[model samples]
Target: MSSPIFTTPDEVEAAFYAALAHADLDRMMAIWSEDDEVVCVHPGSIRLIGLVAIRESWRQLFASGARITVSATHPVRWSNLMTAVHTVHQHVHVEGDDRLHPPIIATNVFARGALGWKMVMHHASPAPDMDNLHSNDSPHIIH
Candidate 1:
């Protein structure tokens, strides 16, 4: 199949999840540029910089037996012709019998380069207790 080209931040975000669903490493890397400034951070994991590190990280994850299903919500976006940033919360559900994994919060950044919009950064972390705790009054609270 042809490589992915991100015309918009939303498209890139969608491709990211699609790649995960298929566990297609090449398709996943297509969302990112080969630039040295590219960065990625999986939930509770250290930051990975440059194409080599980022690719390796994803390669490992894809190699793992677990399959991930991600749902994104509340996208806060900012952009110009050359750069775009999206702060989103991802609810990750792992396939198989295990049902105890918690959701993750992620901040994903993209940039326009020679090819197209390529992901520049993805910083994900486990949500704090307060963020996860049930609160009836807050409509923004993730279930």
Candidate 2:
């Protein structure tokens, strides 16, 4: 079956996290652009470039049979006409794992092509330890 043409970068990002949680490699790859310049960086791992390398890496990971739950928050987005960039704080949980892992900082870049908005790059890294993720000096109300 042909993959859905994602209409927005936000949709692609949503699908990306859903795929990650389910270990759906095909769904994950579908969100990525079909360009030779596409890139992905798994935490603590070397960068993987192009569709072939990225697919192989994901295939290996999904083979482990581990389910990962990803929760992303604190998004910062930038966009012009053809490209968009989104950065967010990521919290990941492994099924059956007791210990909590540090949060990840992720950046996702997307470009509008004939197939609509497709992700061109995803880079994730460990976030720095902070005393609190919430601000103590500011009001908690959303404006």
Top candidate on lDDT is: 2
Q: Per-residue lDDT tens digits of candidate 2, residues 1-143?
A: 79889998999999999999999999999999999999999988999999999999999989999999999999999999899999999998999997899899999999999989999999999885565536466554558
Give the whole-model CA lDDT for all candidates, comma-separated.
Answer: 0.83, 0.92
- The number of clashing residue pairs in model 2 is 0
TM-score of each: 0.85, 0.89
Model 1 Cα displacement at 88 (Å)?
1.0
Local accuracy of candidate 1 as per-residue lDDT tens digits, 16-118: 8899988888999888877888888888788888989988988898899778888988788889988888887788888875676555788888888777788
TM-score of 1: 0.85
Alpha carbon lDDT of residue 67, candidate 2? 92
Assess the local accuracy of residue 14 in candidate 1 as a C-alpha lDDT between 0 and 100: 91
